[model samples]
Target: MVHLSRMCTLVALLVALAGCASAPEPQGNSEILNLQAEAEYAYQLALLDQAETLYLEILRSIPNYAPAWFRLGNIYSRTGRLDAAILAFERCVELEPENQKALYNMALVRLKQSHQIISLARRQNGVDPQVQRQIDGLYQALLRLQQHTPTDSN
Candidate 1:
């Protein structure tokens, strides 16, 4: 009778262990959404590198995640990675054409790049008139975007 009781107890322990092991792990859309939320929270906390990592992870899981792409671009822009930021913003725009933040960020990064180019050109012997005109155009575009951005109440 003791041996039988021990065998029953072992079976019960095994069943409990199996139940714990089989607890549902997040997958599919839920996992992706959770990652995206975590990334946004990290960004809000100004943990930009952590946010970038999470955003990239989300992108890997769901390539068309427009908000993550936009936030990643913002983080890159803050870190002065203008080229990378521009590429990310472009991806965001491609994924969601109506993403105003992505459009603004793309214009801002392009303006910054154009300014750098113009400065370099000025330091050199000769500056191209066409290049200067293009820089002026980007500046105008950036100004327009800045004017249109909604002011944050906080």
Candidate 2:
């Protein structure tokens, strides 16, 4: 009887351990959606810094969150972090190839960076070759985007 009881107890313990060992599927999309909503509300309230932080947190949670990436790019651009903004925009484009907003923002960010580079070149005695090359490339890319982007002035 004692042996049978020990066997039953071992079976119960194994079942409990198996249950505990199972991993839960992540609800990444839903959590990111909630974070995005909160970020939007913060932006609407003029809490720019808070919105930026929340957006960054969302990216940290879901690296491939395309909308969060696009928004972060916008926030970074507004805060004058042009390089980071460009990178975030690139990530958004990579994740969502059909995202026109990301593509447009990327073009805009590149244009801003190019202008900054030109200003720096004028201020310095000698322009850095690498910087000049980057600026030229960015300018060309921006022009191409502008040419391709549709106008809706009417």
Candidate 3:
């Protein structure tokens, strides 16, 4: 049953990402920027595997490149690799704690996976409740992040 459900999810995910557009580019070091163009192009062209590989290679050399991590997360999300997406987004947030987009994406991925986690947990052979609670925390954080900041009233 789980396998069938996963395959159906995979098909739906693929259709949704068939023409998915690339996310915003992050400004990185000049050396990193030099390598980013090809990866970005691959992403824009929806060559997800190629884009992922390129992004991972960049991270290997510059693990602190938050943009690469964010982009990799986006790619993973589009391709239905939710766990990988969460990891990439988490890395992006860790490197750039104030990046709203990374925060949002991390929350989004966690939200999507939370449904699965909760449902599976309720099915008698479920996962630990702590996982569900952690996702709830992330969701709350995302909501706090999306709150509007007061602008100058002058």
The Cα error of candidate 1 at residue 154, in Å, is 13
lDDT agreement of model 3 with the native: 0.67
RMSD of each: 15.4, 15.7, 16.4
How should the candidates be ordered by lDDT, best one leading?
1, 2, 3
Q: For model 3, how does the per-residue alpha-carbon lDDT over 1-154 read when each residue is reduced to its tens digit?
A: 4335334543553343343347433344334555667898998898989998888888787667777788898998878899998888898778767666766777777666765664554455327677667656665654564354321110
lDDT of 1 by residue, 12-43 (tens): 53453345555764345456656767987898
- List candidate 3 stretches off by more than 4 Å: 1-34, 121-154
List, residue by residue over 18-132, the lDDT tens digit for candidate 2. Answer: 4444565345544656676799798767687999899889768656666667777888887889899888889977876766667777777776676676656545644688866
Best by lDDT: 1
- Clashing pairs counted in every model: 0, 0, 1
